[model samples]
Target: MSDTAIRVTGRCRCEKNPVRFEYTKVPAEVHYCLCTDCTDISGGAMALIAVVERSTFRITQGESKIHNYDTKPTCHRRFCSECGCHMFLYVDAFPEHLLIHVPTLDRGQDIGAKPDRYVFVNSKLAWLTLPDDGLPRHQGWANSGAPVEV
Candidate 1:
């Protein structure tokens, strides 16, 4: 991947509001999640998240419309309340960073980099079909990876 930092911009489903963010550095990790909670909340088969430093992201506009939901003790999801668009997530493990949903970002950005692994495959719906490519698949969080530090 090019070392050049990528700029991503997005807005709440309402065109009136906009959010801008840039990654000062490449994300430490990026992946697709097939967990039931993600599917249920986003109404999608999977969610693509880019792990980035909290400081690298900002709400350039409409901060008041940002809403949060603590679905679990450690999982906190954020969305645009005005149009009900799930945008990002914050987990207790990575208090200093935010996970941005790739789809929520501006279109034409190169986020197609396939996920390095599949998470929560055990709960994945039977009707869904993940590609045969040999990406590491996990039942839940990958404990083998280094802990995210603040």
Candidate 2:
């Protein structure tokens, strides 16, 4: 991972409100999630999430427009109420940070790197098959990597 930091900015689908997230430090990790829940929420096959500290994320405007859905007791997904754009998710396990979707960031902001592995492959639809290059595949979340400290 590079030591350099990059600024990431995003907004709702309508672009009415904007949020800025400064990745002051390179992410400890990044990954693609193919879980059913992720796919259902994103309306896509997978979700690209970048684990970032809460301190680095800021809602520059339209804070009230951000709505949250507590899917589980420990998991909360946030989105723009006006545009209904799913931007980030906050988990009780990592209360001090935000998991921002990489695709939501500004077009030019380099997302550091792509996911090195896939998680929740067991729940992935049978129609979808990832490349057989042999990256680590996990039935659920990967616990072998550095744990995110809350």
Candidate 3:
């Protein structure tokens, strides 16, 4: 990946937001989460997340359209009130990081990083079969490249 600074743009489905933002650098980590907290919130089978520094994320547009929901207690998911699509989340458990949903990025934008691991696999849907991508699998999150033993 290029060491040059890369800015990423993300938005909701309303087509009213360009929610421009910068990532200073590439993401610290990326992964697929099968946790119910993620799936249930996004209404998806799983979530592809990029853990980025909070200092690097900036909201450039449609600020008023963004709304926050305290999915649990300290977990906050921010979405567009119009389209109800989640763009990013702030987890108190990992305060320094903003977990961004990769799909929100502008079309054809290079992510510069790929999912390095699969997490919360223990809770993964029974019908889903993981590919042999050679990445580590974790039953839970260790917040690093390391996998947790469930």
Give the Cα lDDT of each candidate.
0.73, 0.74, 0.81
**Model 3 CA deviation exceeding 4 Å by range:** 1-4, 144-150
- lDDT by residue (1-150, candidate 1, tens digit) is 456465556666777764444455466677777788788888888887887778767777778888899888899998888888888889888888888887887787665344677766777788888787777777776554532211
Task: Rank the models by TM-score, top first.
Answer: 3, 2, 1
Off by over 4 Å in 1: 1-4, 111-114, 144-150
Report how far residue 76 has shifted in candidate 3, in Å: 0.4
Candidate 1 has an lDDT of 0.73
> What's the lDDT for residue 32 in model 3?
90
Worst 10 residues of 3 by lDDT: 141-150
Candidate 3 per-residue lDDT over residues 1-37, each given as its tens digit: 5574687777777754545555766788898999899
Cand. 1 TM to true fold = 0.83
lDDT of 1 at 39: 83
**What TM-score, over all chains together, does every model reach?**
0.83, 0.83, 0.88
List per-candidate RMSD values in Å: 5.0, 4.8, 2.6
Deviation of model 1 at 7, angstroms: 2.3
| CA lDDT, candidate 2, residue 100 | 80
List the pairs of residues colliding in candidate 3: none
